[model samples]
Target: MKPAAFDYHAPATANEAVALLADLGDEAKIIAGGQSLVPMLALRLAVFDHLVDLRRLDELGGIEARGDSVWIGAGTTHAAVGRSAEIRRDIPLLHRATPLIGHFQIRNRGTLGGAIAHADAAGEYPVAALTLDARMHTLSPRGTRDIAAADYFTGMWSTAMEPDELLTGVTFPVWRGRTGFAIEEFARRAGDFAMAGATVAVRLDADSRIEQVALGLFGLAPTPLRATTTESEVLGRPAADIDPAEVGRSATAALNAVPADIHGSAEFRRRIGAVMVARAWARAVEEASND
Candidate 1:
């Protein structure tokens, strides 16, 4: 199906893009990469009077390491992030998860900001962002602000972004301690969106005891969720002693609702989520031990 007729505007700057959004309001949608948005538009799942393209915005097209953090422009492609030495060095979780996003063609055209803005519950970027505790920067006619990863995603395919705001970039703080990361996901095929997934990052003390751990669960709830309960159980425990199955149960216990669709039942998704969490935790533990 073809998308409804809409006006298109290519903004050379973020200011111009936000200004266009301010004028068009809810009628305008900002598009970058066009991986997620274009498909939705084509399916008529989303209807907009105008599309404000951010591809030409120079201010939103670079990757840089700033002090203790890595700043990735919203317009940067997934493929670029996956291959970036700086990203792999500063934020290995993101680097490791980028390849799981989609096939090569999709990653080459998918933007970090677009994926986060789309906020698909099954998106790998959201899981990585949550596990890394990333922050999102945004601009609007009124002003600019930073949104914490925990607060950024409000629902499935929904975010805190206002109609007139534009996502400018994402900032991820470099892990300070000895850290290990792993992302485990299950899909019908290599490039398919994960049916369930877990993104895990663990920081260990010199003694090999877990100091800090984060587990982000995807495709099992309305929004990406941090397995805080599971982290609590794993913290301070020796990597070898941490039980992945128990951690999985703890994480799922905190979730009040499990999503069910034509793809799977509520119970099935919950079980899959548990398995993903277990696999991710085990791999993360192994990696941390080696580090």
Candidate 2:
């Protein structure tokens, strides 16, 4: 099916893009890389009257290490992010999770900002941001504002963004000492939209005990969920004392009701999610201690 006709505006600057969005209001959609949005348009599921293309905006694409954080521009392609030296050096979790997004072709076309803007609960970037406590910068013709990742996602396919807002970039804080991060997922097949996935971030103390743990999950709820329940139980515990199986069991405590579809039952998804969480946690912890 052909998409409904729409006006397209390719803007060269962030300010111009924001202005286009403000003028188009609710009728406008932002296109970067066209990974997710293009599909929606082809299926006739989305009916945007205008599209403000950000691909030409030089200001929105790049990856660099700032003073305290690695700043990833909104327009950076997932493939670029997957191979970024900065991302691999400062945050392996982001690098590990990027390949899980889709096939090479899709990753080549998918923009980081597009994923966040789409706000898919099962998407990779959302969980990464949530677990990292990254900061998101959004701009509108009115002005610019920064929002914490913890507060940015309101629901599945929903965000704190106003109608005219454009997400410009994300800032993930650099960790101190030796840090270990791991990502694991359970899907019907490799590269499939993960039926369930989990990301674990572990920071060790001088003694190498678990100092801070952030567990984030996708396809476990309405939004990329931060698993504080599992985190609270893991902190300050020796790696030997915590069973990998026990951490997996804690997944059930963090997630109760997951969406049930043909891919799997809600109950089954919760079980798989738990197992993945445990594996990722143990893997991260092991890497942290060996260093």
TM-score of each: 0.97, 0.97
Residue pairs clashing, model 2: none
- Per-residue lDDT of 233 in model 1: 79
Tens-place lDDT per residue, model 1, 1-291, is 999999999987888888899888888888899988888899999999999888898788789999999999999999999999999888988998998888999999999989999899899998899888999999999999999999999987889999998999999989877788889998889988888889899999999999999999998888889988778878898887878998888888767678777889888888898889989888888887777
What does the lDDT come to for candidate 2?
A: 0.88
Q: Write the per-residue lDDT of candidate 2 for residues 1-291, one digit (tens) a residue.
A: 888999989988888888888888889898898888888999999999998888888788899889989999998999999989889989788998998988999999899989987889988899999999999999988898999999999987999999888999999998877578998888777777788888999888887778888988998888998888778888998766888778877866646568999878998899898888889988988988877
Task: Name the candidate that leads on lDDT.
Answer: 1
